[model samples]
Target: MINLNEVLKTLNDDKQQEFINYLDKKNKRKDAKNIQLVKLLLIDKYSSQEISEKIYGKQNKVALHALRKRLFQSLIDFTANTCIKEENSLDVKLIKYIIAARSFLQKEQIEVGYQILDKAKIIATEYQLFSILNEIYHTKIQYVHQYKTLNLEETICNFKENQQQLIQEDNLNIAYANIRKSLNEYQQKKTIIDIKKLIENTLKTQNISDLSLLSFKSLYQLLQITTISSSQKFDYYNLTSFATETYKIVENHTSKNKQLYYHIEILYLISNIFFRNKKFHQSLKYLQLMNFYMNENKQKYLKDFSSKHDLLLALNYNYIEKQEEAIQLLENSINKKSSNVIQNLDIYLTLIVCYFQHKNLTKAQNLLSKLYHTDKWYLEKAGLVWTIKKNLIDILLQIDSGHINLVESRLKSFKRNYFKHLKDIHQENVIAYLKLVEIYYKNPEKASSKEFYNRVETSFNFIDNKKEDIFMMSFFAWLKAKMTKQDVYLVTLELINS
Candidate 1:
């Protein structure tokens, strides 16, 4: 008979080694059925997902959540089930072991802890406490101590030294800098071919195409630079073309790399450009693409992120006048998150405004009450943008535009105050409102009393709206209706010729 073992071992040594390593890692996982009380007691001690995974073997997030919930729900049951606590009895021996272990760990004395464990193991295999202590000493303590001393000042000093050490030969950072400057200059005057060429050549030389794993750190820095530079100089066509070209290349050749954030940045750029170009569908398309990758990334990685994408999604939908859709998206974003108050506050404020716009003042007031308790939410509520939003909501739902007398009485401040903070992006819609003021000053008859019947005509040419003329006509009619007692519907203007 043939030896089965020999027959099965015919694979090459390289493949065999790889398989062995994989099995070793797989074997280290905790049993799915394994329920340990001690592990739960020490749960708070095991910080970070990666360390928890390493210590527990294979763990699902659901299990961790369930474990915590069970502990809180029934503390006595939690104390009873753990074998480590039962034998050790939380007695002086166990307490002494824990204290010594904690001390050894704090002092980075891993060898001392390991030696203690070995001696304890000789006394009895029942010393499971030693195993936990040893894991803590080796992984947590050793890992933490490898960085530096425990003081903040010393840590800062160490950080600066490390930073200086890394500053050498960062040619990628230099190239990223040049690429951004070129992009900005190109937008301002519509040409930066030579700089673009340099960027293209750098990519070629670095072989940053096809199978080469891209650098996420570099990508984030480059994206940030692009955003800052773009703000300094706005370029519509050239920026869009450049972004589109880059997207095609990256999407086809090297999308598998750590690219979720970069993809989001690219989509944002495209959507903003499309918005400026009066292409609502196109803008929504790019924004949806951004949502797609963001969701994908959230599924794949345990990123250190707060759930703030809801705010962005809501804002985009609101810009396109999809109020209900925006509110739903915000609700979904905040439903399950455990913390990140600042981000949640942002979501809440935006959601409240959306609801207010739809004439749901009761719901908006409820959110405002919740915000009163949340400190960060207060700043956002008292900010300049919130004031404009409040008035817009009042007009959209409660106030009439046709009664010019009524509108003048109600919106007297808005009509007369002349808001001056037009330099901020947060004032985008507000700036459009300011433009209406200027347009009305030159042509007062164009400013209608009925907001619904009165359409937003040629007040601002920059807003992205596919139904531009109709909206302008209807809004002006609506404004006129709100202003004057009679209907004042106007004719729609055709699209501006390119």
Candidate 2:
């Protein structure tokens, strides 16, 4: 519905006039009623019923329905024609000429057909669209057979040469696409074992050395390997090391200004890796480099990048005990209009965490309410992070508000909806943390005692081997603070630094 409004809003005066002309020609008369109906419907708020009644009268229900259908078809046709006129690319023009040539051929307009074919051939050659060029050759051969034109030996040779080049290019493009597709799969699920298998199978079939000739694809594959390998092994030292080396490779090999976006992406990924590994200063450095590259390139439409960058920066701020700065950045970063934001769920979840950490229960509750009621909170089905974090935050909000009954109710719903899926120990830990809270709420003295801290420590023994579990990291820090009688923010920072 929003998309319909946007398309309608894009209808400029010229397009509207064109649509009017189209309707006039179709009707074969200066029918003012349909035109007026169209103009009324084009407005933001006007609807079918309003336009219908105005056109056919409220008594004529059947006629009004027919008129409304006509209006809808007219709008669709107008939009399509407008888009067709706006598409002025060389390939599109070439295809259009080919289509026109075929139409003329059907009418036995030989000269006009050849003229259109000539234009198409020129375009195909200029754009190196050899696939289309092959078609043009066959088409011209048809023209020759029909008209018995001059023998075209040279054109046949040209076709043969183009065919070989086209084959090689297609093969390389397919290989690149396969690698990119596998990389995309890894990114979506972040399962290193699956990606490793995919990559191994791809390597067995394709020459990795040849990939260097395909520079961008090569760089992307190398970057993916570096991150995925490090993540699979949980090796932060080499992750940071590989990230630095990859940054240099990008700077030295890729075109600076043209590949600015990819370069910034590499830096952002590296920074996030560092951030995940508790290397705040290193993460901050890479983030600074990302900003420097963007500044140097003077990139446009950075709202999406800005949103993610702010979220990361806010996270670093919160980790280093700059709660005010973190909260402010999080507050500023919420509900951005950028459709390309990569970490919207993370941003929202982080902001709520920051608010809760600050003990601002009212603001946290308000934000949670907004997120809960907002339609389609989880936009994709790739990860449990969004679901887990969302559930954790809701539980945290209720616990902070001292609403034991509401907390229990939310927990019941959470367990029912998500229990079967929570097979992993890390996932189960979230429920454990919530249950700990419930227990504490029931018996406040035990929560405030040293024995409570020991019990908390003993309870988290299962997480002992889980090094830097990103989802459970903050909760573990909060648990430590509860036991140590320290500030949660300070304890979180200490845990991160440690």
TM agreement with the true structure for every prediction: 0.39, 0.63
In candidate 1, what are the lDDT values of residues 24-119, reduced to their tens digit? 453445553223432332343544364347545666677655644543334333334433543244334544664575577568786565455345
The number of the candidate with the highest lDDT is 2
TM-score of 1: 0.39
Off by over 4 Å in 2: 1-214, 217-238, 296-298, 340-342, 373-382, 424-428, 448-451, 461-467
**lDDT for each of the candidates?**
0.47, 0.65
lDDT of 1 at 6: 31
Query: Which RMSD values do the candidates have, in order?
Result: 19.7, 8.1
lDDT of 2 by residue, 49-129 (tens): 665667766656677556656756877987766556643345577888888888887788877888888888876665456
> Model 1: how far is 243 from its true place, Å?
3.0
